[model samples]
Target: MRAILVLLIIVVLVAIAAIALGFVNVSQTRTASLPTISVKGGSAPAFNVQTANVSVGVENHVVQTPTVDVKKP
Candidate 1:
């Protein structure tokens, strides 16, 4: 039991270290001119997004569901 506990602790620590190092991205900031829109009647428009970062993750998961089959007697 103690050995299992120590192995679990080590695994957790390694996972923490890996996560801390993996987030060190070298993404530099660069400005690009995006298209600006102006309303016809000079009314203040609003936008929602302030600082948005989009990441897509794909994971394969298997789920098993039980099904019941009925037979006519």
Candidate 2:
């Protein structure tokens, strides 16, 4: 039926959007960092950027980390 086809299309669109939004990753190390979530008004939610220092290679190594604002909503 047309209705079933439309429903399937909507589901596919949602799945594609989630994928494009980078919601799934096979490896945890591939994820740069996890955001810190805060609750407000007993229901509202917001995120604070999380960061980490990374060092790579041998002998000549480099360290890098992102600067995130510590503001809370």
Candidate 3:
């Protein structure tokens, strides 16, 4: 159910985006063109972050269960 809801929401958003971008509309006033972009050298920020390492493993164990006595009426 949650998956369906999420899918519906995504589909609605996609439809909205399509309509907003005029992709759904068949009429076009003008041709679209890509903008010329210039790039510059830039340095990214660095972070010294510490994180905890969690290790997980499974262990085998033996368990004893009590036997039930059933009486037929």
Which structure among the candidates has the greatest lDDT?
Answer: 3
Pick by lDDT: 1 or 2, better one: 1
Residue-wise C-alpha lDDT for candidate 1, range 1-73, written one tens digit per residue: 9999999999999888877899534565997888998768666788898887999999999999999999999
lDDT of 2 by residue, 1-73 (tens): 9999999999999888888888854455564768999966665688999899898876966889899989888
Candidate scoring better on lDDT of 2 and 3? 3
Cα TM-score per model: 0.31, 0.33, 0.36
Shift of residue 54 alpha carbon in model 2, Å: 79
Point out the worst 10-residue segment of candidate 2 by lDDT: 24-33
Cα lDDT of model 3 by residue, 1-73, tens digit: 9999999999999999999998898678999999999999999999999999999999999999999999999
Deviation from native of the Cα of residue 63 in model 1, angstroms:
80
What's model 3's TM-score? Answer: 0.36
- Collision pairs in model 1: none
Worst 10 residues of 3 by lDDT: 20-29
What's the CA RMSD of model 2 in angstroms? 27.9
Better of 1 and 3 by lDDT: 3
